[model samples]
Target chain A: MLRYTEDHEWLRAEGEEVVVGITAHAAEQLGDVVFIELPEVGREVTKGEEIVVIESVKAASEITAPLAGTITAVNDAVEADPGSVNSDAAAAWFFRIKPTEPDLTGFMDEAAYQAMIG
Target chain B: MADTPGGLRRTPLHDLHLARGARMVPFAGWEMPVQYPMGVLGEHNHTRAKAGLFDVSHMGQIVLRPAVEWPSGHARPAAHEEVNDLKLRLETLVAADVLGIPQGRQRYGLFTTPEGGVLDDLMIADKGDHLLLVVNAANVEADLAHLRTLEGTDVVLLDARSLMALQGPEAEAVLERLVPGVAAMRFMDVAEFDWDGARLWVSRSGYTGEDGFEISIPDHRAVEFAEALLGDEAVALIGLGARDSLRLEAGMPLYGNDMDAGTTPGSAGLGWSIPKVRRTGGARAGGFPGAERILAELAEGAKATRRGLRPEGRAPIREGVPLYEAETGGEPIGTVRSGGFGPTVGGPIATATLPAHLPEGATVWAELRGKRIPATIVPLPFIKPSYKR
Candidate 1:
């Protein structure tokens, strides 16, 4: 299940682990991503709190945490090549987290994600 | 996504920019190419190493005609022109008495308000029969209106023309092959030559602080000329992003970022624009707006001036970031004007304005992510200039 936030970050839960990254629309608006600050492993994150800092050539924007979770894993691949977000926003998840509350309901699905982006 | 910015304009190179995989961004109401796949850092460093061709067509390239025909307004002298009898008529807008810049030379100048504040910074080139003026894309309409008033006197202004810049170290060698005589013209000089049947006015000047030329080619042949330059192994197509970084590294100020209606040329560290003749009284020519304040600023010194800042970290410090004194941790002083990660310098750099009293090498803080990033005030052109001069 995928859920979206007003800030354009998306969360997808696979069992207890939830993947987090920005949406396609967010990547488009950011132009090109040069550097990204990934959440550290085992860091506790609260919903709507500052999470990541993505720097493009023109500007830098902070990606806020969309849900309360503990970061379990970070996508080292995307950090090696931040352009993955521009190329494939959905597939290029920034990190995976084990939610403090595993029950995530009323979240955005693929259709809702499309609607939000469109 | 939207086509128009309340009815602004684009350039002939718009399509080319898109075709070259550029990220089109809105700038001054024009859909301009900001950067390409190589990215701003790569493009900037490439230009410094080899040659970078910039499609600065979005900039307004105008030709100002003379009110009279025969003498042709005395060929609208270059910006470097001294304050002398014959050269005196050159500058009608600027309070400084120009009339010194010889034909085919160009200089960076400003349109100051009556209060000594800068209205715009423009490049004035004397094309002999007319003046070739390049103004910021955002200030095109206003600059045109201001120049139109002088049309009836001795100056008649021309509208937009196609201008492209082939900059970097290999620029001269590449351009020299196309226009044979251009190589002879010294830096800051211009030459009239023919390139593939096109009459071009090429100037040995560039904003990147590199030895390069800005070729004023006809609009129709702009794409072809661009292609010809891109074909060179030494040249790569660069976009506005690279242009910004290159200028930042060169310590050149962007009009809207480094200068605006609120800043003065003196305050912007453009003292060279104010000819010594204007200062020493070769002529008491003081009429244009803000003569008193501008002259006084020239006499005394600017209260605040723009300087370069280099943060101690790799993270970029953006504009609007506050500058705090690291020593006292007192109230915020200046703000960042332009900042980016300089690829060549291997660190993040920025241009900012601080109190003139602040000592050079003073450590300051730039608020980033609620943390104060330590930065040092240093001389500009973070990288050594590569100009052939």
Candidate 2:
């Protein structure tokens, strides 16, 4: 099951770790991504803390952490070639974070996310 | 494209831009198109390869001439003596060879403050009987007020006209199809032509560093004229985003971004535009508003100067990014005036203000995300101008 944040981030829970990536709508809005800087693994972050910086041809954007946790791993492929995220935003997970409490009770579901975009 | 953001003004080509699927953004109190479906890089290269149509209606067009009128056409015309009088009077504010500008020629000029800093940069054209000034879009009101203080010249704002640019190697051929004799006009040449029962002011100049023409036509006929040009296979609609990168590659300085209230003509590498006649030893020297330091800086090079910087890595070093002499802990030496990915040069390019006359091969460090990026000073204009001489 996929969970969504109001800031256009998606989280997929796999056992104890949660994978985080930007939504397809966010990617489409970002235009062509030329460079991206991902937060380092082992860095502690709180909810709503900005950790990702994406520079597109048109403008620059920052993605924030949805749930407070420790960054366990980051996707190196997207950082190596930032354009790949635009091709498949859902598949280009930025990082994996182990939530402090493992609670996603506040996150929106798919139905609520769809309505929010509309 | 629907209702613009509150307080944001729309150009005459607003509907036409939306019809072509442009992405609109707020720019200097105006809702302008930043890019179209072709995208910024695509439109940039397209303009270089063929021709690109740009809606520059946001720029201010003002007419400066002696108060006495001698003709019916244009904002106003003057007798030859009045024209010369107007030019000399204009010299009181602008630091350029206003008296030397031949009829039908345009030259880059600047307005300087009493403290020797640049207030704005502009294009001054001597249209035989009157002088036409084209200035930056955001500086319209300020420039008008600056010009309003001048005596003996009627400063009229020709706000009802829509300005457009057709640029590239194929620009001359594309424009020649509709208006003959444009092919004969050399660079910086300005002329008046009658098209569709309206006066079309044509100048063989543009901001893109390509061989091009800037046309001023009536606002109501802007859409039809643009449609007529877009009918050609070579012409495509370009927006502000591409216009920016194009000028960056050309090494042209933007008014507010590159050279602002604190920049002097010499510091901005614009001393070449200040003719010898206006310099220290010339016949008419030290008359303009900021002549004291402008002439002083001309003789003795400015302490701070503008130069190009190329980062070693592919990541773009953006504007307002501070630069330091050392990698880790030192005060910033400069800030990026204009910067972006140069599609033509196939790398990231930036221009910044650095201390004058550095020793050979000095590197400035730009810190981004806790990492120091090394950028070496390179000569301006990542891409040399392709203007038709």
Candidate 3:
């Protein structure tokens, strides 16, 4: 199941881990992404903690963790070519995390996320 | 985000901007387009490569006329004595050599406080019978009030007039199609022409380093003129975002960001704007406000000076980032006033207020996001100005 957060991040459950990336709506708002700083693998993060920093030509923004988890993998491709996030935000996952509890209590479904953005 | 706080005012081209899908943002109490569909980076690169039409009507345009008018309705000769008197009266408020500027010429000037601090920066054009001043948008009210406080001068705020800037290498060619004889006018030359029954006061000058023109037309006819200018294949409607980045790449200092009422012209690295006539050794010296301190700073030097900074990394170091010596980590030596990505330059550049006498090529560090990024002090005007001299 795919879930979304109010911060515009999306998480998709992929077997043992959940893939995370910013929604297309967030990428469009950020314009052309120039650079991104992702947290290192094996780094532990709590829910709502900042894990990634994305910078556009004009400004910068932080991406927060939607659920407590350990970062298992990071997308180096997005780091090398940040525009990929703007090109296809859904497929350009920033990192994958092994969830501590697998409980997405605060995350929203697609319909709820769409309504929030609207 | 659609509705601006405080009910932001809109320019005459507001609807046109919306029709073109502009991302509007509140700027200096006005709802102005920060960028369009092209985005800031694209708009900036386009302006450097081709002509960019900018609606700068939010800027204040004021006309200064002599207190006494000619008795007859017929056009009077260039009243040299009256014009001189008007220039002399204006010299009391600004630090530039207004009287020295010839008719049909424009000069950059600054309104300085009594203590040598800059009140505002403006462009003054000698229009034979009257002097026209183009000032910053936010300082219109205060500038008018300051002018009104002076005696023997008739100040008329051209509130009904809208201003636009067509800037880039192809600007002259694009504008010449609409207004003939524009290419003949050299840099800083001001002329008036009639286009489609509407009069345009054009000056061959602009904020961008490119050779361009600033057109002042009636607000009602502004859209017509703008649409005509946009009809050209080389012209694209640029917004304030690109305008700012373009100026920054040109090493131009913004009024509020680079220098405010607290910063002197000399300290702001704009001493050249104050002509020699207003300096210590000239015939008409020490007459304008803050002449004593300004001249002293001019003769000796200021404690802090504005310098261009080239960051070694790609991170956009924005304004207010503190600066420190790269090798020795101690208290900050300076602060960034304006910093952003220079698309043309292909890196992040900034203008910083550094301690005086920091030679060009000196290495410094900008504290950005807890990381100290190395920066090099370089001569201003990161890019060469392509003005048609």
Docking quality category of candidate 1 according to DockQ thresholds: acceptable
The docking category that best describes candidate 2 is acceptable
Kindly list the per-residue Cα lDDT of model 3 for residues B241-301, writing each as its tens digit.
8898899999999999999988889889999998778888987887777888988998898
Candidate 1: the clashing residue pairs are B34-B241, B63-B158, B64-B157, B65-B156, B78-B101, B81-B100, B81-B101, B82-B100, B87-B99, B114-B290
Candidate 3 scores an iRMS of 1.6
lDDT of each: 0.76, 0.88, 0.89
lDDT of 2 by residue, A1-118 (tens): 8999999999999889899999988887777677788999999999889999988776778999998999999999998888787889999999999989798878999999999999
TM-score of chain A, model 1? 0.88
Task: Write one digit per residue (lDDT tens) for candidate 2, span B239-358.
Answer: 999999999999999998889778889989899989899999998886887899888998998888898988876778888899999888989889888887888987778899998876
Runs of candidate 2 exceeding 4 Å displacement: A41-44, A70-72, A98-105, B1-5, B69-77
TM-score of 3: 0.95
Candidate 2 scores an fnat of 0.29
Q: Which lDDT value does model 2 have at B377?
A: 90
User: What are the TM values for chain B, all candidates?
Assistant: 0.89, 0.95, 0.96
Residue pairs whose backbone atoms clash in candidate 2? none
DockQ of 3: 0.57
Tens digits of per-residue lDDT for model 1, B199-222: 887888888878898888777787
